[model samples]
Target: MTAMSLGPAYSRLWTATALSNLGDGIRSAALPLLAASMSTDPVIVAGVAVAGQLPWLLLGLIAGALVDRFDQRRLVVLVDCGRTALLAALTVAVLTGSATVAWIYAIAFACGVGETLRDTATATLLPPLVNDADLERANGRLVNAEVAGNELIGPPVGGYLFGVAMVLPIAINGGTLALAAALIFSLPSVFAPAPTSESKGRIWSETMAGLRWLVRSRRMFTLSLLSGTFAFVDSMWFVVLVLFVQQILELPAAIYGLLVGIGAVGGLIGGFLAARIVRLLGPAPTLTTCLLAAAAGQLMLGLASEVVLAALGLAATSAAFGVWIVVARTQRQRSTPRDLLGRVTSASTTVVMTASPLGALVGGLIGREYGLRAAILLGVPALVIAACLAYAVLRERREPAP
Candidate 1:
């Protein structure tokens, strides 16, 4: 079926995901901005950023195994509920004047654990909700839910709300998670798949089943490597981005969200158009160009002096990111068997997730020692090298053997 035929279940799932994502975007922005208030030390500030991603590195493998073993829908609901509790506690902390960098770090890491499970489960949950032909289209809509909610609307609102009362946005973040859980609960019991008796015995073996496939697949492994490299570089660039914008570019704190928000327009557009682009360029060209975009966009932002150039550069980068994720996720789903989808998806994600914390640590140090300008410049060569390696891998795979 075409994307237009996506059923009620898929639509409901999408809505729930989008709602939570809106809240997630708010949490993602407000927390860092809040942490920034508690300390000027780039390491401390970047540490909170690291807390959010650290779980994916630590818990992603386990979560993927859990997703494959049990009901995905239930995991998502439980994770959302846990997030609600965490956000509520954070709101209380902020209102009570007890909010600390340590508190934020702990909460961020906990929430990230919830995210790692929910993300893998959600990806596994999706295929059952829609037809095979429309997976790409379905994924595109999901990306829009993420980009539009998280980056576009959420950040701008968060930037403004944090000024009114820091507690206000934190409270709202809890409420959204509650609502997302309620929506997810509306799904049928069939949403949870039963693991076959044979697959039940060993989590590690099940997990390894997916990893072995990834190691054996040139395309998936290469793509994962390329993505992992970029993930690392972007993490570093972003850790100090706010400081860069405020101090170096001299943009005021009030417009900070808008600065990131404008770039999200490219994400919104890319989400709408990724399938068309993939079809037009075909997977090889589409994947190759996405790498080029990553390198080029980072260079633009690093070299840009004025706010407008920076925004444009970011927009290009975000657009590329938007297309790249859709393409990667779509390729992943197409390649893996339905039974091992969770494990495979999680294993691949682990590679990308593993890099950001290191990047944050590095970015924090570089921005602290050299400057934010220098920190931003670091991504260019990394992405370029990744892009070149990816092109060679993709091209070489297509050539006829003797």
Candidate 2:
């Protein structure tokens, strides 16, 4: 595929996503650590994590439906503004010595809600902004930006800022969101109005149509299943990794950041190469192989005792995850009609992400009872099971009719 030049409007959207993602990355790392600092209860800290993800499970579909009807660019701006205010409030509360675990949980839940809106709109808007032939490359660029923002820049900076003062990271995160909001406001309208007939339904009926369409599509159904499974297993690892690094390995916070940052480098590489890899391997087979490789990497993590070895395993796992996401996203964009894209993507995301909170709950229990190492090991089997499910359910499928 030839390189497709995006217009100013599309470029602005991409810039906003990249910038906001960086803030999101910082918050993802800092928020949990803040929760941990607030309470000695493992379950409470884990609950904070759950709060952040639970909105995606419950409100994702509704958010998607709204995205389908509303102006996506304006919706994005609204969500970003909401996030900015929420984070700013949290920062102020922390600075004034008024913060508690409950406060953190509330803030997290609010952020999650805003994120669900922003993400659903962003996913649906991409296809309309760029040419059809440029989908893979555009997706690759977005993925690359996300990895750079989330993995490389956000976590490490958050870690250091947390070390200095928890309020600093929160304040910076809010500022980032504010900047993203400003950028979003400048984005030109990317979504065309939905067809008149399609827009003339009750909200519930529209939502059900989206859900039905998604479930009826063989490719989408398989992809959603695979994503949900992957998220479940990954959430398990995420919940345990911090404890393992801090308690078992006895590493400093900065060192933990370094390890995570290094692993994210693999994600960066994977994102950069996603389009090329998809072309070379074909989308379905390449995605399936990546899932298996992710399982293998998790197995290696389960067996690793040394920090360097564990980091390597984490890097490999991240790489596989990154590639799989890009391929899956490209396929979804290619197969789904633009009009139904928002609701369908939201429906699929909600179903798949439902496993995340459950996984986090299980991971916390296992980590507290058996140990963090064992909890990490639990992800190995989950990953393998997910791989098997993908191969059996998705690999033989043909593209769904649009």
Candidate 3:
């Protein structure tokens, strides 16, 4: 399906998502820099990261249940508006010189709560705007926007703005979110699920209902587990990537930043091309190729001593990740019941959230003891295994839509 065929409602959704993610990326970069400036204590600095992630673990299911129960368009608009308010307060604190490490942590956690709700609601809202056959295309466009805004443009802009004036990035983030809220509020009405007796069940049970459905669907469960593994390995490898660039590759810090930008560019390309690749190779083979490419990329990073080689490795891995995201999300949306989309998406996110920190800790330890290269090398086997599983389980025969 063509992009225009997806309709104007989807365009508004896309614009809102891109704007919100740009704000997210700006805050992500600025917050840590702000934290480190406030306190030299490592624990205090780390607390900001932990606080931002805590909501995903604590509220993912609850947010999903709420999305399933409510009007999704209004839910996302409210969440974004709430986030804008929080950021506006934060911007004021920074400008007034009243901001503390504790203040930053609180706002981070609260904004994270808003993120959980907005993201889950947006995911569930998409199906009504596009046909199932066009999900891959639609999802690819969204992923492209996310990669461009979050990785490519937002961080550099945030870092630059922070250097000029600490309050600038924060204020800009607030403005972007406020605009995003307005855009989301303007989306046309979507198909609301007919209320069933089951829809009125308690939140906990409704959340569990999503898990039960995921567990019963063998294909989805397997795919989600693989996705979790990918998230784990990716997070773990990234923790040591800085050290690898500095120590093994002997590249300057500027080179390291350049490599990250290169990787982000690769992700943009990958997301843009994903739908076409899927059409050419079929979904199973495309996913399998991406996994294998990720494995190869990690191997290259582990072995390379030169900046050129290392950059290539990082870009390859990032591109593979980008493609995998579009393919996986499209499959999930197509296979699941509409009523369960929010919950299933959140359940998958919970797995990723739970795995990432553990992976980061493990990577830090292993890299410190064994070597940075070894830490990256260890991720290769996991990706290879995931690739093998994707090929075996996601074959064309068994993947027909329900």
Model 2 lDDT tens row, 26-89: 9888998999997889999888878988888778888877888888878888888888888888
**lDDT for model 3, on a 0 to 1 scale?**
0.86
Error of 3 at 358 (Å): 1.9
Residue 383 C-alpha lDDT in model 1: 77
Full ranking by TM-score: 3, 2, 1
Order of the predicted models by lDDT, top scorer first: 3, 1, 2
- Candidate 1 lDDT, 52-122, residue by residue in tens: 88888887876777787777788889999999999898888888899899899999999889988888988
After best superposition, candidate 1 residue 371: deviation in angstroms? 7.0
Worst 10 residues of 2 by lDDT: 1-10
Least accurate 10 contiguous residues by lDDT in model 3: 393-402
Please write out the lDDT profile of model 3 over residues 1-402, one tens digit for every residue. 434568888887888889989988888888988999988999988888789879999999788888888888888888888888888898889888999888899989998999888888888878888777778889988888787777888888889999998989999999999888888888777745657679475899999998999888878888888888888898888988888888888878888888888888878778888989999999889989999999999999889988878888998999898899999888888888888899999998788888888889899999999989889999999899899998988874564443
lDDT of each: 0.81, 0.80, 0.86
Summed over model 1, clashes come to 0
Off by over 4 Å in 3: 1-5, 199-201, 399-402
lDDT, candidate 2, residue 96?
89
Q: State the displacement of the C-alpha of residue 328, model 1, in Å, after optimal TM-score superposition.
A: 0.3
List pairs with backbone clashes in candidate 1. none
